[model samples]
Target: MNAIGKTAIGLVFALLLSPARAADINAGKSRAAACMGCHGSAGVSNSGLFPSLAGQSRTYLEAQLKHFRSGERVNATMNAMAKDLKDEEIQNLAAYYAGLPGKSAGGDAKLAAAGKEKAAMCMGCHGNELRGNGQFPKLAGQHPDYIARQLTDFKSGARKAGPMNPLAQSLSEDDIKALAEYAGSLH
Candidate 1:
């Protein structure tokens, strides 16, 4: 290969090997100002109807935003919100949200314990701690109503094409309740 081509290839390798640049939290906070209404002051949604973003995995947030933007995940509000977001804004938003503290589900201890059995199914993807890895999302400390609604939506086909749909289809209402209660009780 030519010397110029080799140098260019070496530079590309160096770039690829370098750690990703740290996200700018200040920039993220600035961008997140627009998210405060439904997502609360720092991504902890005050309403049970909206899922909390605080302490969520950045990859999960990024994927969901992209999904909303691409029409794979369709929510009237989210679609609209995500449509105009640049990719960098999405990453910044994810970083900001992930840096904040998560809220509690506040379900009863017994119910949470019962739900732990149901949550076993979730362990495959959500991890043993239920905090989730990249792209799976944190179920720990999520709101009961939100979790139930999502499970119900998956069961009903309102939320389409996710692996959860099939799993949710197999869950009885009581199972859903127990799972939601359990997941919500986590820190």
Candidate 2:
């Protein structure tokens, strides 16, 4: 290609490939104050019922927030919280939470070991580390409450997806508990 065409293509490629720049941290911090009660001071999450938002991908976080707002991923608390947030606000929040470090919730050693066997079915998509990839949210070190809820949702058909719904349905309640316990133990 000619220099002019190449240059134009390069510019377009750069724009497309560049990481999304986060909004003002201070604004996000201020907005995040309300989130601290459940999500922890830096999005780590204090409650078992809530998933830790720390270190989650901004894209994933924003997408989930949008899902909650749209009722695609229904949760009363999240829906109410996310409904009023503007796109920018959601982006800012996502960026802020993504910047935090993740922590391990620690699980029963026995359960974690057994859970590993139970988790074999999950590894194909969730990764061997349970860190997940692309659209799949990381399951490693996730809250048991959150994992259990997702498993329940999958089993009950509240969270419908081709893979997860069937997988969840196949699992017994004990199996779900074992999987959650196992996932929460991984760093």
Off by over 4 Å in 1: 1-8
Decoy 2 TM-score against native: 0.83
lDDT of 1 by residue, 1-187 (tens): 9999999999999999999878877888998887789878967766768888889999999999999999899899999989988888888888988999987768877878889977888988988768877878888888888889998999999987569889999999999898988888886
C-alpha displacement of 138 in model 2, angstroms? 1.4
Residue-level lDDT of model 2, residues 66-103, one tens digit each, is 99999888888889999989998988888887777788
User: In candidate 1, which residue pairs get closer than 3 Å at backbone N, Cα or C atoms, i.e. clash?
Assistant: none
Clashes of 1: 0
Candidate number achieving the greatest TM-score relative to the actual structure = 1
lDDT of each: 0.86, 0.83
Q: Estimate each model's TM-score.
A: 0.91, 0.83
